[model samples]
Target: MATPKSAVYAASKHAVLGFSNALRMELAPIGIHLTTVNLGPVNTNFFDNADPSGKYRQSVRRYMLDPHKVAQKNCKKPL
Candidate 1:
């Protein structure tokens, strides 16, 4: 169980994504619009890199993603 201490943050995003995916499938007959942004790494600093040892720093940094690109692609209004 790879549980992160702050999983709710990831869960909220996943919930919205899951809802949209299912909703889109359900509403396809009616010509409604939807998109699910299944995203990967973006260049930003959300992870801690304070370790003096470069090994841990490098490993830890992989978890983060750039908010700018995520916002640009994912900021659907009327949520």
Candidate 2:
């Protein structure tokens, strides 16, 4: 159950994605490449102290992927 706070966090990540895309374009002429590993809901909090005791949170876990595995697999993509 991410509320208003998640908007800011999600926006920041989207901004980063745009920046990376532009950077890849700029460097492509020099043979540089980039890839964006867009992440979805994972088992972590946007804010460390965020409450995880709610039923919403509990249900979310049933579909949540492990952050470690996400990182490992995504890192192997061209970036």
Candidate 3:
């Protein structure tokens, strides 16, 4: 759960998780693969686009993940 200020982000992520779970179950019988990769904060231009003011980005800079590292890890062991 996110703080009140980030309720929208939390809700949207939860919705994606729920939908992915349902889709995975539905496709299992059909031998279809459904990989849902839930990535953490990646260091990218997303902050510039999402929060141009940089207020939120600066506040969470320490928590941001490295996009290249994340991609490497995902490639090695995807979910």
Candidate 4:
């Protein structure tokens, strides 16, 4: 989902995924675990700043995830 203006953001996400995968392998033998949650945009005030015009937010509102629900699901899951 790399949009036209989000090259740096996309690259940073990829970098995090790469780093986490490497770290997970390195820590597995010691019983340490890591989890990466790659999710689409959530319904939040972030859109107020990121999309001041409200067009993107309006377009994606129906598809946006509930932040609380997302956190609850992730927190309750076994790592």
| Model 3: per-residue Cα lDDT over 8-72, one tens digit each | 88899889989999999999999997888777668899778777888877887898898878777
lDDT of 1 at 55: 50
Give the alpha carbon lDDT tens digit for every residue of 12-53 in model 4.
999999999999999999999999989898999988987688
Clashing pairs in 3: none
TM-score per candidate, chains pooled: 0.48, 0.61, 0.61, 0.69
Between 1 and 4, whose TM-score is larger? Answer: 4
Tens digits of per-residue lDDT, candidate 1, 30-63, equal: 9998977655534444334333344543665566
List ranges where model 4 is wrong by over 4 Å. 74-79
Model 2: clashing residue pairs?
none
Q: Cα deviation of 17 in candidate 4 (Å)?
A: 0.6
Off by over 4 Å in 1: 1-3, 49-57, 60-79
TM-score, model 2 to reference: 0.61
* Candidate 2, superposed: residue stretches over 4 Å from native: 1-4, 45-48, 51-56, 71-79
lDDT of 2 by residue, 1-79 (tens): 3355377766888798889999999999999999887655677764245554455457566777787787777586643
Clashing pairs in 1: none
lDDT of 2 at 18: 83
